[model samples]
Target chain A: MITEQHILSAFDRDLESVQAMIMKMGGLVEAALSDAAAALETQDEALAEQVRKGDAAIDALEESVNAECARLIALRGPIAGDLRTVLTVMKIATALERSGDYAKNLAKRALVLGQLAPIPGAAGAIRRLARQVGLLLKDALDAFIARDAGLAEDVRQRDLEVDQMYNALFREFLTFMMEDPRNITACMHLHFIAKNIERVGDHATTIAEQVIYLTTGTLPGGDRPKADLTVEGQ
Target chain B: MITEQHILSAFDRDLESVQAMIMKMGGLVEAALSDAAAALETQDEALAEQVRKGDAAIDALEESVNAECARLIALRGPIAGDLRTVLTVMKIATALERSGDYAKNLAKRALVLGQLAPIPGAAGAIRRLARQVGLLLKDALDAFIARDAGLAEDVRQRDLEVDQMYNALFREFLTFMMEDPRNITACMHLHFIAKNIERVGDHATTIAEQVIYLTTGTLPGGDRPKADLTVEGQ
Candidate 1:
């Protein structure tokens, strides 16, 4: 009993709802990552516990998104653009789920590394990396929400900074382990936590790329690019 | 103008052709990875050249597959299962492309490390790890082609072995670097090459998981609880 106008309106509503849900999920995941990093810095087991508990909510949100995406795909019979949106939502859900997993890993590593006395200044580098990745992740989602190709491209470019920091942190941690063999276990735990954050940055870049692809039929890489890198073009 | 039987036969032919292309691409990528390892071991620019050359063919195959997939999606109103198959093919193509990129990175590293007099005995571990992952990559695709859940599960389990070997190799390379500071660059190259192969193992695991999901409607992991070795997997 639905006309074309009704169908289009319903599709718009569903897309908005789905986007809202994704933002909620992304916020929760970002909090979990930040808390995990904070726990590492402060040796706070309670924050780690919060991160662990937050996974259940992330999982639930993911299941909800999947169900909604499935319903939209089945009902709307969308064209390539809608199809890409639905597919990107599904993929972003999975990416967020994995990011939650990484955050949990970081929390656990924090708890383990906390048992050791302290490594001065190591925690700050991890914190900076986490903050930068968090910004990238937020901007990537913002790009998706606004269909802002320029923002997505910026997010993609930021990934290199995260990688460079990760590499430097890895070497620093390696040096720490070598300097004091007793600190090996703690440093290794930190190494993995840092790696998890770096991977989160990678997933953020992936989401940005997907956004770029979804908006434009062409995938971003190599020349002959279609989208301009400024908000004015968006 | 076409009978149902004829249409079905065309689908079958198209499916087989796509699968053949994917397998061919997979083989070339695996060979390139193996050659990268060999190049690093033997300090052979020739083998590195082969890998770099092979990447062009992989790119060509990927483009062809992308075009065919687009045509099929546009022309054929594939149903749910068939849609899933087409979508999986696209995602699998991406995984294969990334695997090729990793191999290309390995080859580039090999070329750089080759000029600095190859480290003796370091390549064995890299080769062994590459061989294991190569086999896993082949077997994973085989399982996908056959829709054999048992084979897919076996490939999933085999990934653990590659992970173990990678960690062990990492430790050994660390020891080598610690013994001689001059070995640092060469050892880092070996580490990244091993890491690339290990990542290939991971991608194979991801593909196998997708195959399982395509059959069983459930993602991999979280089914049977076991002693989790990796910090991320638990």
Candidate 2:
């Protein structure tokens, strides 16, 4: 004999399992990003290659997460707030999978950049950007788990700092390219890595936005201030 | 007073309304891409600005689609195939919205590239690529509406051609940049535009894949081949 309470507890357990998979995916993405940044700085082809291979795992995790979410919706028939929670998880998984791809891209470029002469201070600058975005992602996931709308909004504001850092790096790379024609190839590659990190910051902000929406039932009103000079609102 | 048959018919009508919004959004995205491509070829700053400002409508449409899908799910409690169809609409909206953003980014770059002397033949090549991707998006939406798995699979294959075109253009831009230091800035910008189109092609492929999934209840077997050089497997 099954009571309503049994079904409710089972749904809770299922949601917890799915949410744990999301956290696991988030952890994998974070490690990939930080590791890719470190590989770029050290020109470690091996580490970079490892990061590239690891992306398949992230991709698999996202697939599992999506399948699980769809199943939960179909089986549980969750309504209102529960439905919003499920949808938000699906959106976050998409963002995380994309960020993982960016990390893989950085690794591929790192392999290429490893063969070339290291640009002075360029990798360090990119690492700083990566670290900042990593913290943004870490905190966004934290906010999601805690359902802390305030902390999520804080993460949203911090993306502007990431954007500013990216701008500074972009100008620096352009200067390097202009100063020495020989640096053009390296600078171009470095510019892309910086841009990738900047986009990752945007994804982190997206996660924060999703968390806020999940908790508050509405997206933030004011436009998240954009300082990414070139790419123009994307 | 409503019978079971009436309730079933109402669900069908609601679904048709939501899908109609998707087609409308698709049409807007296609126009934005083609117009941006044209603006690039002619260096029409005014036209480019129009495209940039027009992205808001696409974004709004996507938001509306999502909201309506959520409402339908909550109110109707759709299950099985109906649930998958609604979810696919949401996914397609996301792809269309992102493609629209890419078009807007192209316009933004076109504004900058206008001040600089045009790179010989680059704009024409990009236009051709955009046109190919535009056709892909059109066909993908058609596949979705008709529930034609074959057409969806066809659209998936066509993206490889877009990737090949991108690789050719990438090499062309690299040669232009290497031949003259003066061309580096213009070439870099052109490269990004080409890259964006390749991504648009990917989004179309995503839509096509979603269609197959919705129709067949399983993802297509094997990985779709990729040929874009430099951005390896992105």
Candidate 3:
């Protein structure tokens, strides 16, 4: 018969494996985000295609993480903190997968925008936004690995900056579109790319929130501050 | 000592209760979508506020469902198909919660747009799109309750129509903004509202996909046939 200690060790090993996969998935997502932003900045269609293709791997990792999570829960019957950790791993994988999708979308838009006249300053602003989101995602993953709720909260707070950047870009795009209708098509695509980057930040915040919940057993109180003034009156 | 049959029956009862909660949550989301669209069509600020306020209930229900799913998993130790069902329930609750948020966003935008000049045919098109998405959400939940994969696939396919409608509206809004800059601010808000409704359809499709995966151990393949031409040629 299998001993109790053996089962406990196996569960710990399983948990570590899942966590490792999540980190691997996070790495791929970070790379995709950077590449997508770089592709946009340089108007590199080939690099954009690479980011789009890379999404499938991230998606497959999510599927594996989900299966492993379900398997661990079924076979080990984890409770309390261990259970929360497993569930959080699943949630983090989901957030990472979504971030990957947003990156893919940005890359897809970059490919089309490459064919059009470049919008001055828009690509640079998008790259900065993507970099900020990348930093937030890195901190979110690190917090998850360390179970540091404070660091996770820090990541969550930074998302407000991302929203502000997105709102600024929104106004800038409106100005570009108004200056010349010829810029409208290109500006609209850039606006979407900016929006996609903002969404990546939101996903990063979601991962951070999951970490906070996993650590504290309670979500952060009140709504996270929203700095996106695009629809402020509403 | 508890017999095997006792544990099995208890698990069944737990599953039934979670499913009931999911149905209730779905009902609230459907109502919110309808009301948000109605408010936009009639420029009814009071109705919009009602839809916005109603979102809290949907969110609360989602929290309850998540807690119950965790409890069921910990207490019952469900495996294989039962485990998938529990996970799918949690996912469906999340999708429903997101749909509620989108509906709330639509209502919020409607409140702002009510003060602006009406965009010709835009409000009516949005209402029709919302109605179709509401129908899709209804069918997705029904498929979940009945374990009907075919119906879920049908819901998944219908999402393409929602995307097509959204793309058409995008062009219409672009025309309005180009013809008169006075319509720019209103059209931008309308564009966002339409985008939110399109996101609602996406969430409904996600729920349907989860239902398909729950019923059949495999997700439907081939990229789900997106019809959104906004970012086409990527």
Candidate 4:
């Protein structure tokens, strides 16, 4: 019986270690999003380069988390809820990795945008959008650690705000391009950057959804409300 | 000893079931891509709607595959190569699901584009790109099923062709927008649709990477060459 207790404790420790790794990965992604936004706002090529380089770390961490999850399952053979938690961790890591990729893509575009004249207010709007997404990501990860379904739902709802901001920026960029053809090139790059940020929000929502599923044993119903009416009339 | 053989056979059967489901899911995604492109080329709204609705089945298959993987792991406790195969199945299903979403997005855009005047040869370009992506997806999945690392590497390399086509399309769309403002909206939508196709190719490459990792037990080293210079520099 003592040996059984020891085995259970070791399993718990393994699960905690996976959670810790996920938090570490989440932190890297958060930094990537923030640094990517800051680099875009300041047009800092070096910082943008840093954001791009940082992605490899996030990708590596995701692989580590995945390997650990598989190892835990194979060794301990966790059942039901414990199994779900490990699977959720793997899913969340993938979402974070993709979010990191989007940030890297944004930073890459920022480096290109640095060469051209900025469209007025574009950088500020992008920074705001990025900030919102970063916060949602943090909240989603917190909800996962705390097992707080309510907070996860809140993060899911907040994604609509990100989408709305993206839509506003989409229209704003279109107006800028229509007003002056010179703004076209810069606006297009900004649009792609904004789209990338919006994708980060979507990934955050995915994490939130996974959290809810982990806690509730069922996914949330109904389609997520999307406000990014960029291509309307679907 | 007889029971051990029975257990091993059951594990093998479970793994085979997951692989079969993945192939079924891949077929749906390939169809989605082709139908989306054909709808865009022919401006068939009905076909576009059908493609949009068809995504639900792909999504359902992904859920089934995930559940099966979790159950197999918990019940059978597959280890080493078997565990990796199951994990790869889940990852591949996810990539396929995202590819389906992109195809659905393209179909939605196709519905919109059907209302407007056709851009000369843009539909053909999109169709060709979609066909290439579809082929890549097929090869990637086949490689996964066959454990053919060489074929997986070929699929990885073919993604570059999709990216190059996307770059060329980007330049073409820019020319169209610069020549006439009337083309801006259509071209923007078309550009997005083409971007979706390119993204499908990326997901295909992701599956190929997973296949290579599954077969060889090591991810391919160095970054996958990206030829999509849409956001160049830094």
Superposing all C-alpha atoms, what RMSD in Å does each candidate have to the true structure? 5.6, 2.4, 1.7, 1.2
Residues B101-150 of candidate 4 have per-residue lDDT tens digits of 99998998888887777789999999999999999999999999999999
What TM value does chain A in model 1 reach?
0.92
Off by over 4 Å in 1: A49-71, A115-117, A167-192, A223-234, B1-14, B49-71, B111-120, B174-189, B220-234
TM-score of each: 0.82, 0.95, 0.97, 0.98
DockQ of every candidate: 0.21, 0.42, 0.58, 0.61
Ranking by TM-score: 4, 3, 2, 1
Q: Could you tell me the lDDT of residue B161 within candidate 2?
A: 95
User: Of 1 and 3, which scores higher on TM-score?
Assistant: 3
Candidate 1 vs candidate 2, TM-score winner: 2
Q: After superposition, how far is residue A2 of candidate 2 from its true place, in Å?
A: 9.9
Query: Clashing residue pairs in candidate 4, if any?
Result: none
What lDDT score goes with residue B123 in model 2?
93
User: Which of candidates 1 and 3 reaches a greater lDDT?
Assistant: 3
Clashing pairs in 3: none
After TM-score superposition, what is the CA distance of residue A21 in candidate 1 from its true location, in Å? Answer: 4.0
Name the better of 2 and 4 by lDDT. Answer: 4
Task: Count steric clashes of candidate 2.
Answer: 0
lDDT rank, highest first?
A: 4, 3, 2, 1
TM-score of 4: 0.98
Model 1 chain A lDDT-worst window of ten: A225-234
